[model samples]
Target chain A: MHGLVNRAIQSFVTDTYGPDRWRRVTEAAELGDFEFEAMLIYDDAVTEALLAAFCADLGRSRGEVLEDLGTYLVSHPSVEALRRLLRFGGDSYVDFLHSLDDLNDRARLAVPDLHLPALDLREEGAGRYTLACGPGMPGFGWVMMGILRAMADDYGALVLLEHHGPHADEGADDEADEVIAVTLIESAFAAGRAFDLGARAG
Target chain B: MIAEDTLAGILARLCPMHLLVDDSGVIRRVGPTLQKLRPETPMPGQRFLDLFDLTRPRKVGCFADLLTGEGKLGVAFRDAPHTALKGQIVPLPGGAVIDLSFGISLIDAVRDYALTSADFAATSLAIELLYLVEAKSAVMGEYGQLSRRLQTARISAEEQAFTDTLTGLKNRRAMDHVLTRKAASGMPYSVMHIDLDFFKQVNDSLGHAAGDHVLQQVARILVEETRQEDTVARVGGDEFVIVFDNLTDRPRLRRIAERLIDRLQQPMLFQGRPCAISASIGIAPSVEQPLVSPAGLLRLADLALYDAKHAGRSTLRFATPRPAEPAWTRPAAGKDGETAPPSAVSGRDS
Candidate 1:
C-alpha cells in the first residue's frame, strides 16, 4: 500500500480522536514509530494492523472506523485538496454520482500508484441511482457510503442511502461485489430558504 | 448564470489567486481574489507571463507550454516578492486556466494560508516525517554529549590513578611503569635512589605538617635540578626515585646526585622556622650490567644506598657487581670515606 493511506489513518486518528489516542493505537499495533512519508511504499500489513488497533482503541467495528475516516476525508482541513478534487467532479449531486466511475482516473492524476476499487453507477429512476462496488477492499463500501452522504450535503441535496448484501451465488466466490441504492429526498437549500421565510414572517 | 460567471465563482471560491490566458499569451481574465491580493498589476490586457515568473519545468517558454506540461508548476509573481504559488494549467476552449494554490513552507502555509488539518489529507505525511527526524536529531545530540563527558571522565581518572596527591609528582605506579618499559627495552639507563637523611627528625620536632612542607620544597628542587627527560617519583614516605634514560656515565650521575643533595640542604621556611634536610643517593648504571631487570636494578640501588648511609649521611655511592662471598657481610669504610674493597660492593654477588 501507498504511505498516503497510512498517513490518512494517522491524521484521522490524531485529528478526530487526539494524538494521545493515536499513540496508544500505534503502541497496541506494536509499531515503535508511526511517522509515514507521503511518497513511500509500505507493507499492506501495516495499514491492516493499524485499522485493527484503531478499532480496538475506540471499541468500534472496522466498518464504523472506515466510515469515520471517509467523513474525515471530506471535512478535515488537512485533506482539503482531496475535498476540492471531489467537488470538481460535478456542479450537481446527480452529476457527481455519475462521476464516481471516473474517480480512479482522477485520483491517478494526483497519485499515479493509487489502486482504488472500480465503481459502477446505474440510473434506476427519477431521483434514484444504484452504485455497485467491486471487491478486493474490505469494509470500503461503508467508507464510500459516508463520502456519498457528505457529497450530498456539499451539493445541498438531502438523500436516502441503503446498502445491500452480496448476491447469494456471488458470496461463494472470492470476489463478491456490494451495492448501494441512493434516493434524493429534496433540496436542502430550498428547505433552508423556507425556514428563513418562516422566521421572517413570525 | 453565464458559463464565465460560474467559472469565475468556482475559481474565486477554490483558489486564493488564479490566471486565465489566451493562446497568444494575452491575459483574458484574472480571478477577483487575485485582483484583490495584487491590485497594482494591470489585469485585462497585460501578458500573463510578464507578471508571473515560471520557476519549474525549465524549458517552458510560454503560457501555452505550461498548459501542456506534466504535473504542477511553481511560479512567483514579479510584483509580489517572496510569495510563491503551485498550480496546474487546464486547457480551455481558446486559451487555458491556471489554477493556483499558495506554495509555502509547511509552517508558513499553516500560518499565512490558513491551512488546517483537512489540508494535510491522507497524501501529506511531511509533518510526521519531520517529527521523526527531529526526534532522531535530539537523540544524537544527547549521545554526543554523553560521549564527550565519558571521555573527560576517563582522562581525569587516568591522571588521578598515576599521580601523587601530596607532591603533585608521578607516584610509585608511574615510576614502576616507566622502569619496567625501559628495562624491557634493554637500553642503557640509570636509576637514582634517594633517602632523606633527617626527614624523621623534622617530623619528630616540627610536626608532620612541617615535614610535608619540607618534602614539597625538596620535590620542587628535584624537579628543577634534573633534566626534563628524567622521571622523578615519590615511592614511599621519606624516599624518592629518579629514572634517567641514556645517562649511564658514572661521573655525570654522581654530579647530578651531589647537586640534588646540595639543593635539598638549602633552608626552607616552615612555620616561621628554617628547616635543614639532606639526601643520601645511590646510582645504579644499567650500562655496567646489561642483564639487570627492573626489580634487580631497584635492589642494587637500595644496596648502594645502604653503603652511602654507612659511609656517612649526605653522600652518594655507585653500585658495582657483588663479590663471591656471604651476602650478609658489610663493607668497612676506608679513610677516604669510600667503601673499602671495590669487589666487596658488588650488587649481583650480593
Candidate 2:
C-alpha cells in the first residue's frame, strides 16, 4: 500500500515536469540547503499586480479565488511569477505552499481523469469541524480533500513557527491540521478504493 | 421387489455436506445445501480475531463468520458436522479445504469407518502431507505483505527512538545524526540554539500538563520555523537546536529569528487557559567562522544562545563563526543594489 502511494506520487511528479526534473529535485532535497542551486525567484508589488491580472483574465469569481486562496489564477504570468518566487525566495516554506496551491489548480485544469469537488467546512463549535460529505466519486472528492489538507498542514507549520519558547496560536492550527490530515487519509482510502476494491477507478 | 440396499451403499461414497475457505480466510464456498445458509456479505476482509462469535477460533475449520450485505462487519456460526470430507477446487492451485476431520481425530474417524488402524493412519498421513504442501504455498503468498509490514515497522521504530516522547519531537539521537552529518557535508549551515524563558513558573503555577502543552505547542512552532531539510530537535527539556542548512543570507536568517520571537510572544491558549510563553534564541552562522569540528559548532551556537538568554527572554542574538572577517556581509538594503554576498542571487532563479 505504501508502495502504491509512492507510485502515485512518482507518477504525479513525472507527469508534471518529466523524470529528469524530478531527479534533480530529489537530488536537491537530499543535498540539503548549501550545495543546492538557488531556486527562489523574487516578486514585488508590480509582479504581484501582474499576477493579480490573471484573476480577471481567467474570469474567476471572487468566491472562487478567495475560497481557494488564489488557486484559480494560472495565467503564464502567474505561473512564471510563482516560478520566480519558487526559485529565489529561498523560503522552501513559501515555495511548498505555492506548489500545493498550484497542485490544487493543476488537478482541476490539467488532470482530465480526476473528478473531485471542493470540500465544505462547518464550524461545529469554537474550534470544532464537521465535513458533511458522502463517499465521493470513487472517492475522488475525498482524495482532493486530503491533498488540500496535507498542503495546509505542511505549509501552515512552516509558516507560523517559532525557534523556541511558548509556541502560540497552536490550538487554532491544531484544529486546522487535524482537519487537513483527516481529509488526506479519507482521500487515500477513497483513492485506494478500500471501501469497494472490486469497482474500477472511474 | 428389491429392498434398495444398493442405493445406501452408493450414497455413502460421498459426504452429504462440506464447508470450505480460501487460505486467506475469505469464505470461498460452502457445500451445496449450505450455500444459501452462508450470509450474502463478504468475509474476505475480516481479520481472524474479529471473525467469529466463538470465544476463540479453533485451528480447525468448523467456525464461520456471519456478516450481512447491509451491516458493517459481523459474525455467525454453524455446528461442525464431523466428516472425512474431501473435495477439489483446482483453479485455486492450492489444495481445496476440507471443513471436517482434518483434526487430530482423522485417523480414529477413518478407523470407525471400518478401515484398519494402520491403513487409516497411512492414508490420512498422505492427505496431511498434501495439506502441508498447500500450507507452505499459502505462506509464500503472504511473504510480500509481511516484508512490507516489517519495513514500515522498522522506519517507525527508528523515528520513535529518535523522538522525545513527551512532545513528540526529535530528540538527542536526531541531533547526534544531524551534527554528525553537518561535519561531513562541507556545506555552510547555521545552528540556532534556543532556550525557553521561565518555563518553571508555568510548572509551578499551573501543572505539568500545562508545561507539557506548552512544550507541544513549541514543538509545533519549531517545526514551522525550519526547512523540511533542516533538523529541529529538542536536545534538552527546555532547549532546542535548529540546524539551518543552505545559507540564503544573514538577513534571511535574522528574519526567521525575528518571526520566531514575535510568534512566541503571543499569548498561548492551552487546555482552555491562556498562558504567556517566551524564549531566547542564539544564532551561530556557519560561514563566518571555520568550525574546527561539529562540537565546536555546537559550542558556538550555545554561546549565541546563552548570550540571548542573558539579553532576556523573547530575545534573538547572532554569533558569527569568525570575529575577524567583517568583509563578507550582504547588503540587505544596499544603495547600489550590488548585493555583496553571493548569497543574494537576483530574485527568482527557478
Candidate 3:
C-alpha cells in the first residue's frame, strides 16, 4: 500500500511536470494505518493536555500578527478543507483559530530550550511555511498540524507549509514519562508574557 | 517516534495540515488535513526555501497570510508584510527566544448566532475581556515608554538647573535659591569674594584658553577650601563669590580666609603645565548686630576684596574695619608690611 501511494504520487508529479519541473513529488511514508496519518494530522483531544492555556498578545494582534518567523504557521489547502470538515461554522472558526495561534505560540516559545527567531516582514516570503514535527512518542506534530491547517483557511492567497513526519521526530519520547498538564491559566501566562508582565526580555 | 496516543490526541485537537523541515529548509511532510484546504499545490515535502528567499535572516516576502476552517482554530494572517519583531523576543531559561504574536479573526453571522447558549452567554464577556486586555496592554506599553522618556527629561532639566557644566559648582540661580531659602529662615550667613589679581593681564598674555585653565583651578581650590554647605559662584569672568551660612564664630571665618590665601598662593597647574594664579579674598560676616541682605553682604565682601588686591595679590581681608559703615572699604595689612591708607589702596576703575 505504501508502495502504491508512492507510485501514484510519483506518476502524478511526472504527468504534471514532463520531468521538467525542478523537483518531483513522491510519498515519504511510514508503515502506518491510513487513518494513522489522519489521526496524526488532526488529533489533539486525546492527550492529557500539558497545559490548559489561553493567551492574548495585543501587540501582535494590532501592530503585527506574529513576531517569530521561525515558528510561525503558514497554512494552505489541506488545512482549509479539514477546517470546514471540523464544523468550524463560518468565520467563527476564523476567530477561534486566530485565538489558538496566540495560545500555541505562547506555549512553544515558553519551552525551556527554544528561542525561535522572530517573524519578520523584511524577511517573510510570498509563500507561507510552518514546522510540523512529532517526537515519536508524545509528539507535538498534531498540535503543529492543527495550527498549520487553521492557518491555511485563514489566508486564501498565502501558502504555509508544515514540516512533519518520522524524520522530523524530535526523539523526546523515552526521556520523560508523564506528560505535564499545566493549568490553562499557566500556559496563557507563560505564552502571553508577550502580553503579560509588560515588556521585559525573556 | 511521537507517542501514538498523545500524537493522536493532539492531532484530534489541532487538525494541523502542514510541516516543514527544521533544518535544510525543506517541506518534510503535509498531513491529509492540509490537502483539503487547497485543492491544488502538491505541497507535501516540497523544499519551501527552494522557490524563494528563506536564506536572509530578517526579511518579509508575504503581505497577507491566513488559516481557516474547523478542527482548525481561528487563525488569521495579516495583509501587511511580515516585519520580524526582533526586539519582541522573549527568552526562556535555556536561551530560547519567544517572539511575540497575536491572532485576528473574521466574524461570520451564522457562526456568531450559532454559539451554545452557555458559550453565547460568555460571548460578550469574552469579547469584553479581550478588549479590556487589549486596551490594558496598549496602555502599559505606552506607559513604559513614557516613563523612560520622563526620566530622561528629568535628568536633562536637572543638569541644566543645578550645576555649572565646566566647574561643577552651584550655579548663580541655584546658589541664590538655596541661600534665599536659608536666609528666609533667619539663619546666619556670611559671604566671601575671591578675585584674581591682574586677571586681565593673564588673559591678555596667555590667551583665554590659559585663563580658563587658571579659572578652573581656582574654582577647584575655592571649592576644596569651603564647607560642603557653602555656596560658590563664578559670577563674573574673573570674580567668584562664596556664601557660608549658619556659622557660630569669627575665628572660623578668619581661619577659612587664611587657608584660602595660603592654598591659592601655590602655583596653579594649568593644562598639565605650571602657570601662576593669585587671588585677593574678601570676607563679610552675616551676623545679627548689623544684618545685611544677600546683595549688601556681597557688596561688602567685594570692597574688602579690593583692599586685599591693593595690599598684595594673594591676600585675605576681613570686614572688621569701619563696621556698620554703609560702604565698607579698607586696606588689609600684609603681616610683612604696614597697612596703606584708603587713598593709597584705591584702584582706578577698569
Candidate 4:
C-alpha cells in the first residue's frame, strides 16, 4: 500500500479521535513506535493490521469506519485540497455525478503511482445512478457512498445513497465489485458554497 | 429542406453563440447566449462588421469575405471584456450562419460572464479542461510541500552526523573533512592536539558521570580559548584537536595552549565532589614545516603530545622543525614522494 493512503488514515484518526487514542490503537496493534511517511511504501498487511486494531478499539464494524473516513476526507479542513479537486468535476450536482466515471483517470493524473479502484457510473433513470466500484481494496463502496452524501450536500442538493455490498455470486471475496446507488432528490435545495475558476483570491 | 424558422430554433439550441447576418452585412439575429454578452437586445439594424472586429481571416471587410474563409475564423466583441470567439461559417441561400465558442479564454470568460454548465453544449469538453487545470494546481501544491520536507530532513541528518553526542562539538569525521580542505587551501595555519590528564582516575575513583562532567568542562575551556575561525573537534574519548585558521605565529599559538591548560586545570564539582583534572597541549605551526599534509601535521602534533606526557603530564610542548631528508633517502616514486612516513620528532620550547 502507498504510504500516502496510510498517512491519510493516520491523519484521519489523529485529527478526529485525538493523538492519545491513536497511540492506544498503534500499541494494541503491536506496532512499536511506528510512523507513516507520506512518500514511502508499506506492506499491505500493515494497513490490515491498523484497520483491525482501529475497529477493535472503537467496537465499530470495518465498513462503518471506512465510510466515516471517506466523509472526513471531503469535508475536513485539514484536507481542503481534496474538496477543491473534486469540486472541479462540474457546476451542478447532476453534472458532478456524471463525472464520476472518469474519477479513476483523473486521480492517476495527480499521483501517478496511486492506484484507485475503477469507477463506473451508470444512469438507470432521471436522477438515479448506480456507481460500480471495481475490485481493489475491500469495502470501498461504503467509502464512495460517504463521499457522495457529502458532495451532494456541498452542492446544496438533497440526495439519498445506499451501499450494496459485493455481489453474492462472487462468494464474499475481495475480488467482487461493490456498488453504491444514488438518488438525487433536489438539485437546488438551497444556495451552495461558492466556487470560482481562479482558485486563489486576487 | 428545413424551414428558416425551424432552422433558427435548432441553431439556437445547438450553438447559443451563433449569429445570422443578412446579405447586406447587417445583423438580423443573435443567439441567446451571445445576446447575454451585451446589454442591448434586438440588434437587428446593427452592422455585423460594426459589432465585431475580425481578428483572424483578417481580410473580411464585407459579408462576401465570410463565405470565402476556409478554416476556423476568429472574432472579438468590440465591447467591455472583449471576449474572443472561434467558429466556422455555413453559407445559406441569402446569408451566412456563424457558430462560435470560446477557445482558450474559457477561464476569464466563465468568470466574467457568470456562465454555468447549462450555457454550454452537453457534449463540450470544457468541463474536462477545467478538471485538468484544478488537478494540476492541487498536485503542484503537494509537490511543493514534499520538496520542503525533503530539504529539511537532509539538512537535519547532516548536522546530526557531524556532531558529537557527548560534548555537542564537531566529531572526528567533521574534523577530518574540514582539516583536509584547510590543508589544500594554500594558507598558513596551526594544529593543536590536546589530551586530558588524570581523566581515567576520575572514572576509577568517582564514577563515569564525573569523568563525563570533566570532559565537558575541558571542551568548554578549549572553545573559550580559541577564535571562531578555528575548528574545535572531539576526536577521541579524552582527546580533542583544533585547527586554527591563518594563524601560524608560534608565540601566539603557545599562549593559547597555556591559557587552555590553565583553564582546564580548574576543579569542577560534580555531585558536590571536586573532580580535579588537567590538559596537556602540543602544537604544530605550518610556518615550521610548509610541505606537510593534514594527516602528517596531525601526527606531528601527536608526537609533541607524547613528549609533553613524558615531561611531567600537564605542560605544553611545540613540535620542532624537521631536518631535510638526505637525497639517498628520498623515494623514487613520482608526485607523492613527500607523503612518506614522518620520522621521529623531538619536542622543544619555541
Instruction: Say which candidate scores most in DockQ.
Output: 4
Tens-digit lDDT string for candidate 4 (A26-111): 88888966778666678888988888899889998877888888888888888877776788788888878877887888887767
Candidate 2 lDDT tens digits, A1-202 = 1222223333433444466644554444442211111112222232223223423443554223222332211112322222222222112333333334333233333223332333344444432333322222122223334333333342332111111111111212212221222211221122210111111112
Candidate 1: what is its chain A TM-score? 0.86
* lDDT by residue (tens digit), candidate 1, B1-350: 34876876666555535677787778777765456445566577988777778787667765677767674878777764446767787778887787766544444444443433333323344333333333344334435665776799888897668777789778999999999999778778898999998888888999989999998888888889888988999988988999998899898998899999888888789978988888898888887756667767776777788788767779988887543221332343444544444434444321
Per-model TM-score on C-alpha atoms: 0.38, 0.31, 0.34, 0.63
iRMS (Å) per candidate = 17.3, 27.5, 16.9, 2.8
Output the lDDT of residue A81, model 4: 71
Tens-digit per-residue lDDT, A1-202, candidate 3: 1221222222323343343321311111221222111101222322111111100211122101111211222232212222222222213323333344343243232222222222211112222222322132333443334343433334331233333333212333423321211111111222210111111111
Docking class of 1: incorrect
* Angstrom error at residue B22, model 4: 2.5
In what order do the candidates fall by lDDT, top score first?
A: 4, 1, 2, 3
TM-score of chain A of each: 0.86, 0.24, 0.23, 0.92
Q: Please write out the lDDT profile of model 1 over residues A1-202, one tens digit for every residue.
A: 7766777778888889888988898889999656665556788788877888888778887666777788888767776555555664554677678879977765565566767778899998887888888875656677788888877776778999887755322234427677889998875553211111001110
What candidate 1 gets wrong by more than 4 Å, as runs, is A166-174, A187-202, B1-350
Q: How many clashing pairs per prediction, in order? A: 17, 20, 100, 0
In model 1, how large is the Cα lDDT of residue B83?
A: 60
lDDT of 4 at B141: 65
Q: lDDT of all the models against the reference?
A: 0.71, 0.46, 0.43, 0.79
Give the Cα-based TM-score of candidate 4 against the true structure: 0.63
Could you report the DockQ of all the candidates, in the order they appear? 0.02, 0.01, 0.01, 0.21
